[model samples]
Target: TAFAGVDPGVNESGSYAPKSVPTSKRGSSNLRKTLFQAMDVLIKTMPQDDPVYQFMDRKRTQGKPYYVYMTAGANKFLRIYYGRVKEYLSVLPDPS
Candidate 1:
């Protein structure tokens, strides 16, 4: 998540904390842009069965802002991607 810069940013001073937090966006800009684009497509398609779409839709229904839902969807997408990749790699034969 942080690697993709979609992770939430930390904002604190002394004992104070803001009510709203934004993304860290410390990773590659191009990668973030690509993820946002993918999210837009998912929203346009409105795939009810897709978990990412479902998550974003829920956020939207909750009155969350556009970027908020989009970022959340992107984060969810990356998490799913990581899980599938890990599972696939776990089944690979040893190089040796």
Candidate 2:
């Protein structure tokens, strides 16, 4: 849901494809809102050594807008969630 909601759309038609990150309105509004809020808290409270914090800090230094950085963080959060869940499921015994 976060992936659907937060990821940018690709434009593949033009000779020069300018990269853009448009805020998508295609997924669960509630989930998107919650993720955005969670990211805000994490950004404020997470230590500098944390990778998400480092990513956000880099974006800040690069002059990305606050909301853009927050959305990127949410996208990162979803990818991490998927990876951990996949790993956990892989370790579980199969049902007969």
Candidate 3:
């Protein structure tokens, strides 16, 4: 398992971080869609402004409906987060 600064626990569940999620009668595709919609609405917004952002910061998302939504939101946030970090790091010269 890959080690993430966000969480140190080795998730044996594989690359599918969303596996902890269990789809309702709506199923995976619907859940994925829900996640996408939430991410689009939430990722750019401030944490205090959105509940999903708060959940991702806690890193304790459940596998039910809320979890799926937050996972999607976190997914979008992390992508943007990584891009911002990379952009910042690229501006600096390497010490080595």
Candidate 4:
């Protein structure tokens, strides 16, 4: 999430937190752009069983802005991707 820069930004001071937070945007812009494009496809295709699409749709219905939901969806996508990859790697035999 942070690696892709889709993680939400943290803006806090002493004991105050803003009502709204934005993406950190500290990672590869190309990656972020690609993820956003993927999200657009998901929105258009409307895959009801896809968890990422469901999450984005839920956020959209809740009145969140386009970018907010898209970024959240991208973050969710990366998390799912990471988990699957980790699971696959764990089952591979050691090269040694």
In terms of TM-score, the best-performing candidate is 1
Local accuracy of candidate 2 as per-residue lDDT tens digits, 21-67: 47756778888889888888887797876777788778888999998
Query: How displaced is residue 48 in candidate 1, in Å?
Result: 1.4
Model 2 misplaced stretches (Cα beyond 4 Å): 1-4, 10-21
Tell me the tens digit of each residue's lDDT in model 3 across 1-96: 011222223345655574342323233455455545666565466457555576554553454455445554555555676788999999999999
Q: In model 3, where is the ten-residue run with the lowest total lDDT?
A: 1-10
* Candidate 3, residue 69: lDDT: 51
Off by over 4 Å in 4: none
Over 1-96, each residue of candidate 1 has an lDDT whose tens digit, in order, gives 888898999999999989989899999889999999999999999999999999999999999999999999999999999999999999999999
Better of 2 and 3 by TM-score: 2
**Scored by CA lDDT, what does every candidate get?**
0.94, 0.79, 0.51, 0.93
Ranking by TM-score: 1, 4, 2, 3
RMSD of each: 0.8, 2.1, 12.6, 1.0
Which residue runs does candidate 3 get wrong by more than 4 Å? 1-64
Clashing pairs in 4: none
Candidate 2 C-alpha error for residue 50, in Å: 2.5
For model 1, what is the error of residue 84's alpha carbon versus the real structure, in angstroms, after optimal superposition?
0.4
TM-score of 4: 0.94
Question: If both were scored by lDDT, which would come out higher, candidate 2 or candidate 4?
Answer: 4
Residue 50 deviation, candidate 4, in Å?
0.8
Candidate 3 has what TM-score? 0.36
Off by over 4 Å in 1: none
In candidate 1 the C-alpha lDDT for residue 27 amounts to 92
